[model samples]
Target: MPAASASSARSNSALSGSRCHDRLRTFHERLQSGWRMSAPLELFSYWRSSAAYRVRIGLNIKALAYVTHPVHLVRDGGEQHAAAYAQLNPQQLVPTLRHGAVVVPQSLAILEYLEEAFPDSARLLPAAPFERARVRALAQAIACDVHPLNNLRVMQLLEREWQRDAAQRLHWTQHWMQQGFAALELQLANALHTASFCHGDTPGLADCVLIPQLYNARRFEVDLAPYPTLQRIEQACLALPAFDAARPEMQIDAVV
Candidate 1:
């Protein structure tokens, strides 16, 4: 077996193990805890959205129980605009987490809320404040810089309003991804703070955002040969169960 194949197999196995454990945890919470009514969490999501994917990773990392409600983004002129979906999320974004009455919007805000609400869970940010800031910086580098410009809605706008052809769209995606990856490569290469994962031995916010952006980059056929450090970190992150489970391809609503 080739190395990549072996690696992919191991990742799939780990993902299966994580999901099995999640189900068991969920079962114990419901059956053993005597909750007959409602689940603790409700995650409004679209499977392919990377923003939602980030929140999913955070949920998995904390081992929190949350049921996903898929919202189709492209069907019927975008279901996100429907009155029902709009009521849940005024911003019309996919990842709207309902923790009791509190509706959390934005992936980063959701992650922060999870960290605060469940402080006992594995720390997503480091102990030191500066270290935590560094992690946030790395995460935002991809989330803000790379993803927004290449989002489906944005691409559609470029096509309709700006009259961009398919070739132009590809150029735009590659252009932004290359810029983000190039800067990220330099940051990761020089910073000794980076380790097996984005921050240290364990995966953090940076790893979560990085993996999704890399997925998009590949989808756009962006040459990753220029960003070896980013690739190495992605490989390291995906080897772990939390990151593997959050992969776009593994989502329940994934096309393939």
Candidate 2:
């Protein structure tokens, strides 16, 4: 093929990609408008679960109204294990989102869903591909590497299955939390992406994930002084009403 022909084809490909993005954005705008005209969304959540806390931030950031159906993870042998809630989420996890007939499970997936389903909401992802990837990598570094190993089930296993005492269990949690935060601190301490929040001036996915983990860190009595970058970011996030309102202590069913 001629060089001129190849150039023309490339131009056409770029145009096609731009058009597709515009159409998708238009669809999302319509969805957001429709949601505003409807009732509040329903979320199955446990106030103390970090994953659930993350979802609450996303919902508030989107400016989407939602009513929480408290799924006590501990009371009455864990309400999430009941037959009714299991039908919505077979995994028996907190933070399951219900919008109309569409049910979404998984915290990260639900965040992405809100972004796509309600583009008018606060932008959870940057328009640039590389920036979005970076933000996701930062968020996953905590959500996957840190939070999972330190969750309630893990603590329960340490007590019931392993017979580890409270002091030993606290040590176990502090170990993994420190390991994860040390690497994250290095990543954010001086990077260009570091700002008031996780990505840029606006709070997005990384902020959503990080704030919850910080809450967890304090809960386990992990010494946070070592990670100034994380602590600074958490302070910035908590200053915002959307994030402050989503905190575990602010929930209707928060335990004493």
Q: Which has the greatest TM-score? A: 2
Task: Pull out the clashing pairs in model 2.
Answer: none
Q: State candidate 1's TM-score.
A: 0.84
The TM-score measured for candidate 2 stands at: 0.86
Which candidate wins on lDDT? 2
Summarize candidate 1's per-residue lDDT along 61-137 as a digit string, tens digits: 88888888888899899888999879988999788998776788899889988887777788789999899999999
Task: Note the residue pairs that clash in candidate 1.
Answer: none
Model 2 lDDT tens row, 1-256: 8999999999999999999999999999778678644845788999899999999999899898889999999988899999999999999988899987789999999999888877767899999999999999999999999999999888999999989999999999999999999999999998998898888899999999999999999989999999999999998889999999998989999986
How much is 79 displaced in model 1, in angstroms? 1.3
| Candidate 1: worst-modelled 10 consecutive residues by lDDT | 30-39
